[model samples]
Target: MPKGIYNVPEAYNEPVLSYAPGTKEREQVAAAFKEMYNSTVDVPMYIGSEEIRTGKTRDINPPFDHKKSVGKYHEGDVSHVEKAIKSALDARTKWAALSWEHRASIFLKAAELIAGPYRAKINAATMIGQAKTVHQAEIDAACEFIDFLRFNVEFMTQIYAEQPVSSDGIWNRMEYRPLEGFIYAITPFNFTAIAGNLPASPAMMGNVVVWKPSASQMLSANVIMEVFKLAGLPDGVINMVQGNAAEISDTIFDHTDFAGVHYTGSTAVFNGIWGKIGQNINKYKTYPRIVGETGGKDFVLAHPSSIPAQVATALSRGAFEYQGQKCSAASRAYIPKSIWPEVKELLVKAVKSMKMGSTEDMSNFVSAVIHEGSFDKLASYIDAAKKASDAEIVVGGGYDKSKGWFIEPTVIETSNPKYDTMCTELFGPVLTVHVYDDTKWEETLKLVDETSPYALTGAIFSQDRYAIEQATKALENCAGNFYINDKPTGAVVGQQPFGGARASGTNDKAGSVLNLLRWVSPRTIKETFVPPTDYRYPFLG
Candidate 1:
C-alpha cells in the first residue's frame, strides 16, 4: 500500500505518429493489420468474471470491403443485460470503496500499455475495424485515448485535493465518493478513443460501468477490453454487452440500478434515451447522471481579410476527416462575398485532390463511410443538390457503392443561407458554402448563430483583430468549442476539454475534472478539536 498523499506526473497530450514511409511504427501496424485481417476473431459478451458466448452471433466486416468477413460477435438478449447490470451492482460496493490511487493506477497503466506494447495492435484494429486511415488511427485509437487515461488520473487528484477551508477549532476534509451505482456508456463507432474513454473514465473514478459499443465498432472495442484486463482492472468492474439495442437498452434503462449514461451519437437517439430515463427515474435508486455529446451543424466563418488558402485547408481537413462523421465536422461555411471566388477555387482544388480508398493504403486520405445506410443518405443529399436551382456542386459529388461505401469529398455552394445543407447536420463528406456581404459581418455572425439548432463547434478566420473580437462575442453561444484560425475538429483531450451547449450536450466538458466530478458526490467532513459538552447557544446562556 502507498503511504503518502501523492501527485500524479505532469500530463501532456500524446504526440501523433506520422507513420511515414519506411518507419518501424508503420511496419508494425501494417503487420498487425495484415495478421488480424487474415484471421477471424470471435468476441464474447462480458458478464462478471465470466465470458458468456451466446450461440447467436452477427458477422462483421470492414466498411472498405464488406464482402470480406473479419469476425463475429456474440449477441445476447434481455436476460444477459439483466445479468450484466446485476453483476455491476454486486461489484459496486467493492469498487467504490477502493482507494482512489489504486483506481487511478489501473488506468495509468492502461495508458502506458497503449503508448507502448499495445499501440500497434490497437491502432491496427481501429484502422481495419472502423475504416480509419493510419494517421487517423494514430491520433484517435493510440494518442487521444492515451491522453484521456493519463489526464484522467491527474484530474482525479485535482478533484480529491479540493477541500473546504477549516476554521481554527476544526479540521475539515473532503471525501469524493463514487456514485452508488454503475454508469451506462453508449459509445459511437467513429473513434476508438471515445469508445474506450466513455467507460474507463468513470471506472477510473471508482464507478463500475455497463458499456455498450456501437455494433459497428466491436473489433476495436474488444481490443480495449483486452487492454483493461492486462492493466489488472478487476473483473465485474466494467461489463461489455452486445445484442438488440432496443432490447438491451430497455432492459438496462428499466433497471433500478441504472446510475448514469455517457453517450455520443445522434440527437434523436439521445433524446429517446433521455425520455426513457425520465420515465423510469422514479424506479432508479438515485437520479441518474446524463452526459452526452450529440449532433452538430458545425460551421467555419471566414472574414474577407483572411487568407483563402488557410480557409481552404481548414475546410478540406475539417469537413472530410473520418469521412466527416465527427460531431465537430465543419459541415457549413460562411464566406464573405469579397473572397468567395478565390476561396471557392482553392477549396475545390483541395477537395478534388483528396484520395478515397481502403485504409491499408498509406497514401489514401479518406476511406469508406461506416455503412451502406450512411452512403445512401449522403448520395441522396448529393442528388438533391444537383436538382435544386439554388445549390450547385462545384468539385466532387460522386458516389460508388460497387466495392466500398465511398462518397467523394463534395462541396455544395448554396445561395440560400437557410438551405437544408447549411442548417442541417448531414454528417458526411458534404460541405455547404453560403456567401454573405463582407460589410455585414455582424449580421452574418447572427445568421450563422441562429441558423443551426445545434451549438457544438465553429471556427472563424480573420486578420483584423476587431472582426475577430466581434465574431467571437457574437457567436459565443453558438459553439461549445470555438476556434480561431484553426479547424473545428480534432480537439485535444486536456487542452480543449470538449463539449457544447444547448442541443449539443450538457457541456460537462469531457476530458476535464468537471466531467469526473459528475461520477462522484463530495462530502465535507467537519471535525471539532474541542467538543462542545453543552448543546446550547449564546442566546440560551
Candidate 2:
C-alpha cells in the first residue's frame, strides 16, 4: 500500500461529439466504418493469457446490411465457461490484492484511450455491430462508456474514503473489499457502453469478472476487450466467453466461487438467473450479489397544459432514437384530448420525415433494429395494430427486411389504454399513444402507473407546475427515472444515475456511487490505542 493517500481526477461526463456532415469526426468515423465493414476480423474467446478460438464460429453482419459480412466470432462451449470461471478465480487473488489506486489508474487509462485514440473506431464498431446511428454510437459507445469508466473511478475513491467515525480512544476505518470469488457479467447488445460497464465496474472495485457479451454485440465487444488489453488490463481479470447463454449461465451459476453477477438484459433472463442462483444457493462460498437492469415499458404522459410541439419532439426523439431499443425508450404514451390533435400532427410529420437506412448515411435519423428477431417482433406488432380495432397506425408503419432489418419509425394511436401495444414493451421504433380526457389527469396518471410491469423510465409533459407536481407524486413508482419536460431516453452518467425497480431492475442507479457500492463488501475496523487487561467492559463491571 502507498504511504500517502491519493485522489482521483474529478469525473465529468464526456462531451458528446456531433458528427455533422462537414465535421472532421464525421469524415474520420465514416472512413473507419468503411474499413471495418469491408474487412473480415476473427474474434476469439479470451481466457487467461490465451485466445481460445473454437472451430464453431458465427459470422457478424450489420443489421442494416445483413447480407454483407463484417467479421466472425468463435463460439465457446461449457468447458470454456468453466475455464473462464477458473481463470477469474485464479486471477482474483492478485487482482483484488493490488493497490486500489493502480486499479483506478487502469480504468482511467481506458477512459482516456477511448476518448483519444479509439473514439472513432469504437463508434464505428458500435454503428456497424449494433446498428446505431453516428450520434447514438457517439453517445453510447464513445462518450457514455468513457464517462462510466472515469465516473466509476471517482465513485470508487469516494467509497474508499467513506471512513467510519472514530471514537476518542479507538481509531475506526472502513475497507471496501471486492466480493469474495468471481463476478459474472452478462452484457447486452444495445449499448457498447453497457457492454463495457457490466464487467468493468466490478473489476474496477477489485473483483475478477467472467464476461459473456451478447452474441449480436460481438463485433464491438471484441473491440472493448482489445481496448482493455491495450490499457494493460490483466488477461484473466476479465475473461470473455461467447456461446449459448443458457450453457454459459448454468456453468457460472453452479460454480462454488461464483460471487456475483452484473447484468443488463431481458427481465425473463434475469429472473431465470435469479431462480437458478436460488436453487443453487447452498453451493456458493458466499451469497452472490445480483445486479441487473432489465426490460422496460417506459412511458410518456402529456398534460393538457403541455406544449404540443414539445410533447411531439419528446415522443419523436424519446421513442424513435436507436429504433426505440433502449430500456428507457418511450414505448407508450398517454396524451390528453386537448393537445392530441396538435401533438398528433407534429409527431406524425416528424416521424414521416425521419430518414431510415444505414448508419453510414449521417443524415438518416433511424437505422435497422438489432437483428431479425427484433425486426420480426416489431413487424408482428405493427401487423397486429393494423388489424386491431382498438389501435390504428397513425403515420409510419412500413417495415422491410429485404436488404436490411429496417422498420420505419412508427406511431400507433390506441383507443384503449389497456391495448397490447400500449401496455407491452415493443422494443422497436413503435410508440403507442392513448388520448385521455383532459379533466382526468389524476385518473390517467393512475392508468399509466398500472399499465405496465416495468418501471425503468418515463416522462411527463406539462407546462403547469401543479400538474407536473401531481404527476411526479402520483406516478412516482411507475418510473425510476422520470423526466419533467425532456425525454427519458438519454440518462447522462453523473447528472442522472439510471436504473429502475419493479420488473425493470434493482434500481441500483448506475453512473453513481450506488452502483459501485453493490460490487464491494465493506468492512468496518475499530482499533483501541491501548489494550485493557480486564476482559469485561465498564458496563459489564
- Backbone atom clashes (below 3 Å) for every candidate: 0, 0
lDDT of 1 by residue, 139-186 (tens): 999999999999999998988888899989999999988887789999
The TM-scores, one per candidate, come to 0.98, 0.99
In the predicted model 1, the residue pairs found to clash are none
Candidate 2 lDDT over residue span 1-541, tens digit each: 3387888899988988878768989999999999999899999999999999998999999999999999899999999999898888889889999998889889999999999889989999999999999999999999999999999999998888888788789999889999999999999999999999999999999999999999999999999999999999987999999999899999989989899999999999999999999999999999999999999999999998899999999999999999999999999999999889999999999988899999999899999998999989999999999999989999888999999999999999998999998878788999999999988988898999998999999999888899899889998998999999999899999999999999998999989999999999989888999978878888986
Candidate 2 lowest-lDDT run of ten:
1-10
Give the CA lDDT, 0 to 100, for residue 313 in model 1.
Answer: 94
TM-score of decoy 2: 0.99
> What's the lDDT for residue 85 in model 2?
86
TM-score, prediction 1: 0.98
lDDT (Cα, 0-100) at 229 in candidate 1: 91
